[model samples]
Target: MKIIVTPSQPYSDQKPGTSGLRKKVKIFQQEHYLENFVQSLFDTLVVPNDAVLVVGGDGRYHNRQAIQTIISMAAANGFTRVLIGQGGILSTPAASHVIRKYKTFGGMVLSASHNQGGIHGDFGIKYNIGNGGPAPEKITDEVFAKSKVIAEYKISDLPLVDIDTIGETQFAGAVSDQTFTVQVIDAVQDYADLMQSLFDFKAIRQLLASGFEMKFDAMHAVTGPYAKEIFVNRLGASTDSLMNCEPSEDFGGGHPDPNLTYAEELVKIMFAGENALDFGAASDGDGDRNMILGQNFFVTPSDSLAVLAANATLVPAYKNGIAGVARSMPTSGAVDRVAAKLNIPSFETPTGWKFFGNLMDAGQVTLCGEESFGTSSSHVREKDGLWAVLFWLNVIAVKQMSVEAILKAHWLEYGRNVYSRHDYEAIPTEAANSVIAHIKSQFSSLPGQVFGSYTVKLCDDFSYHDPIDGSVSNNQGIRVLFTDGSRIVFRLSGTGTEGATLRIYLEAYEPDSAKHHLDAQVALAEMIRIALQISQLVEKTGRVAPTVIT
Candidate 1:
């Protein structure tokens, strides 16, 4: 096949958000649109002639087509090797593991995580550095800047490789000293091996065989194959234990977000009185985030992180000890208590997984998470869904306790941080900006003021100075701290594709064991009322209630 240099112009709006550049499928289908960005990434990466690039997606619509284009473009760019998952499918966490395990230069993961996927739905691409984490802001900014002036992109006229086969295909004829190679790999094995090394699988299998009923919902997304292989084949769980274990491009027309709003099917089944199982779990579209449920209990992501940190030593990978821990700013303080008890450093950064990458790389943090249903350790560099699942199972098998009992005991030891996040999605950008501006304006006057039953202790816009790199990020979010240890935080969601999403996080710490049993909403009712009144959220947004509460 001959290499073709296709002329093209730059495309605006190519900048990546908190995660990646995500847009409707139509935008990506435009002539020379995807190529311009791909070329821009290639230009910014500046990989070697023999460098390896791993490419795969979440099995969404147009995933295969995009992979074919990338393979051709990689070959033309003088890359020697490319590794893609069979059928062009790789969950976000699995892709990260493959990149680290292979020591590739970097990787391209095509996934709009937790977003709907189809012809009209969202498609995305994220570049992960050789460390198996999302490329830091510096690299992403360079790619965006390059996309504006990119002129021509190189591509080969080779026919598309059959990605369904797990084998290597080599390009022929005159070229570089070494032939370009594309290898289709089994996606689940590497990730499974990593999980097995971290977990006590034999104990989990014994628990399953001794009548521990459980259910894992893949949501018909990329985790289907991973879960099917790990839970059923390796753990000896029955086939009926898995739901929607076949990857679907459109996620069966569902939202594919593992929240109460999107994963309602799992919620309903797990909440059923006598029909509930011993354990229930669900993974999002790209399989990084997770929602853990036990019988009728829904363990919030913040709680899940705290639980994992509190019991990290139970797992084999962390049996020695965790170096430290971290959490996104909006996450609850549950983990902080654990960190304090263990006498380890606990760093808090803005709301993105990339912020944790530096800490993990520097060995300052072994476990980290955000409030957005994400949790992971130093394992690979991204939030891992199945890893959290197996951690919980291992804890249960060792303690011989139910999820609720474990939570009660944990709260008894570390107190309770009741937390909730309210998302008002798709608000006009201007309106969202005005809301944030108002919060900033009130910061000076909020301190020493009383609203409802609480007196404000302080108010300010949050900022973080990365200890590893000494880079500073300011105004990450607005927060109001009360004298009673209650808090309210407001920020704009950076990952949404629609209009700006306003996120309001509320938390109240309770040390009294008797009051821990109250409903979270009820326990924080006064603080919620005061927060809404102060922000004038109803009048500003013209929406009485949040779009979604988690």
Candidate 2:
């Protein structure tokens, strides 16, 4: 095949956010748009000799075409081998595992990650380093800089390889002496094996056999096959326990976020009157986020991390002990309490997985999570939805208790951290900025003020100082702390493709065991009102109520 050099213009909007470069499918379909960004990323990397590349996606619209384009470009860019998942499908965590298990130089994960999928929906691509973690800020910044000035891109005039079969295909590269190979492998097997090695699968199987009913919803995206392989084929869960397990290009015309508002079908069944299953869980598009429930009881992401840390030794992987723990800045202090009780260090960082990557690589933390339903340990870089669910199952099997029982006991031991997040989505950019500005303007005078039953203790924009690399990330979010340990946070979410997303996080500590059963929204109603009033969010955005509350 011959190498083709095509001239292209730079697109200033190619800069990646906290995750990756996400945009509408139509934007990616523009002439040389996707090629420009991919080539820019390649140009910033120093390809090692005989280096391999892992490539796959969440099976969304344009995934197959994008994989083909990336493969052809990899050949032209001197990659000796490319290992893609069968049928161009790989959950985000599964992709991370494949990159590490194969010891590839790097990998390209194609996903919008919980975003809607369709011709008019979102598409995204991000490169992960060899350590199976998202690329750090230095690499992402360099790629963005390269994208701004890119003038041309290179591709090989090679036919698309068969990605549906589990086999290897070889073809001559642009250079006569170079040969490029493509291997299509079963995406679920390696990840399942990894899970088996880490957890006590036998105990989990026995628990299921002993009438511990459960339900798992894949949201019609990636992780359907992986969940089936682990929960059904390996753990003996019946087929009826699975929901929306078939992968769909458009996610069955539903938003693929695993939240109360988006995963309504699963939530309804899990919260059914007296007929609910023992345990219920759902994973989002690309399979990186999870929502866990148990017989009408919902576990907040903050409490989930704390509970996992408190009982981590019950699971085989963490039986010995844990090194340390970490959580995002906006996350409640529940995990910190667990870390304190365990005599382990706990870190608070900004809202990206890359920060946790640095700490994990340095061995400073064994488990880390964010408040947005994302959780994982050092087993792999990205958050694993199925892995978290399996961890909970393993813990349940060992403890021989229901999910609600475990949570109540946990709250009784360590004070409950009542928490909720309210999201105002699709707000105009100018209005969102105004809301943030309104909050920041009051930071000087807001301290020492009294609002209802709470008195302000501090106010500032959240910032993170990386312990491993000594890098500083400033202006992460706005925080208003009250004297009673109850606080509120305001942030502009970077994951959405439409207008800006304003997220308000509310948290209040309750040490009384009797009050642990109170609804989170009810417990923090005063703080939520104060948060909105402090930021003037409703007045500026004209949104009387948030788009979603969780």
Candidate 3:
């Protein structure tokens, strides 16, 4: 009934990155490749024999097959129950809610997360803790270590499970009298319930009832069904408000990243001038990333975090006032000002969501976000796209104002931070590292030096000492702060699947409301030039311009 097979050699390259082990579908389809990694994850966890293993994915090309394999292996490895999303569809946030709701022994999520999805595109698998958040770096390290020395994997010879049907199916287990059970759940209910509890749905419905126009682009990815269920069915929005609300295995041959580059269709519709909708939003693959747009205007992720922080009391979940806030290092400091005004602690962690785990667990922060089109409160562990959309809608509903009007009022009250990030993707790893090293080496001599209009006020390699667990992470990034409150940071991205990605972040504060209307690129043009000269990015990577800008 159980098949225990030894892998001839360990997989040296199975190290999990910031998210998970992502690779081409071909890599996962190789004989015993998926099994080896799954076994390694199981071996790293202290799962009980009768524990339930929640399994699901974004419904990508390899998601169904991967789920079947995971179910079989779960049975062989001692799990007595598995609860999965129907049709192998589960957004990242929904999967997190499921795990926490069921109190399972963690869970596995199959997703590449905003990456392209096809035969040659990327696929991924990650383990989530019982708190509905990603496993901390400590657990991921153990899983990666096990992957290097894994010798064998266990799997059952059970037939492929039918994930489409929404009910329970039982099978014989290891013992003669034992039977394992699999439950297929409605993917949208639990998370929608969470949203309902957090916001004033009646207000949102009333706003929608008043003939407001909004468009939600799901990008042919996992959020389609969930968005349709919540926005159209639950709210009073018309059917036409949803775009590409269908889950496709290859995401219709498109990258599902909800950015200006990937969600061009939504961008076009939202910025269509006189014909533009009142509001526009898009969610990335697996539904953890989001892009919010007002009529003919884009809301940068940094501003979104700050705006949410400034007005968090408007939402029901945060009406009692938020405890604190945390953000990635490269994210703009707008929220920091909000925290200061509230007299609450604001933490600056490294570029990964896992870094916020300790802070959140210690109840030091109520909201957290990143510059990468991601935002979330303490509602769920991972950055949630739909939850963010609802928050915006709730704000608009209660304020009875346009998205742009809200932004203007907020900026007028609390100065604006013009922020942008440039990404050099798929460069040589050696070259990317060189750029970081070059910038870091300049830190010692950068202080008191002048670069064009900016005089260096401080220079250092950013290091974070966890207040909750007392762990230290060093060399997270290189930050150069000017005397005038402007900043430039350089770091190599950990979420890339290719050679390497170098990220340069630019931010400059503008206290005068009159100057708030200046273009972001125009305002930071000098800082951008100085950053290039300081890091020698163009010479090192031979990239005259960034592959993407956000």
Maximum-TM-score candidate:
2
Per-residue lDDT of candidate 2, residues 1-550 (tens digit): 7789999999999989999999999999999999999999999897877999999989999999999999999988889999999999999999999999989998999999999998889999999999999998889999999999999999989897899999999997767788899999997999999999999999999999999889999999998999889999999999998999999989999999988999999999999979999999999889999989999989988888999999999999999999999999999999999999999999999998878998888988999899999999999999889888999999999999889999999999998999999999999999999999999999889999999999999999998889898888999999999999999999999999999999999999999999999999899888888988898888898999999999
Off by over 4 Å in 2: none
lDDT of each: 0.91, 0.93, 0.89
Q: How far is candidate 3 from the true structure (C-alpha RMSD, Å)?
A: 1.3
Q: On residues 348-407, what C-alpha lDDT tens digit does candidate 1 reach at each position?
A: 899888999999999999999999999999889999998889999999999899998899
Checking candidate 1 for backbone clashes, the offending pairs are none
TM-score per model over all chains: 0.98, 0.99, 0.98
Tell me how far the alpha carbon of residue 426 in candidate 1 is from the true structure, in angstroms, after superposition.
1.5
Candidate 2 backbone clash number = 0
Of the pair 2 and 3, which is ahead by lDDT?
A: 2
Q: What are the per-model C-alpha RMSD values against the true structure?
A: 1.2, 0.8, 1.3
lDDT of 3 at 75: 88
lDDT of 3 by residue, 440-494 (tens): 7877888999887789999888998888888888888888999998999988877
Worst 10 residues of 2 by lDDT: 171-180
Query: What's the distance in Å from true for residue 89, model 1?
Result: 0.6
After superposition, which runs of candidate 3 have C-alpha atoms over 4 Å from their true positions? none
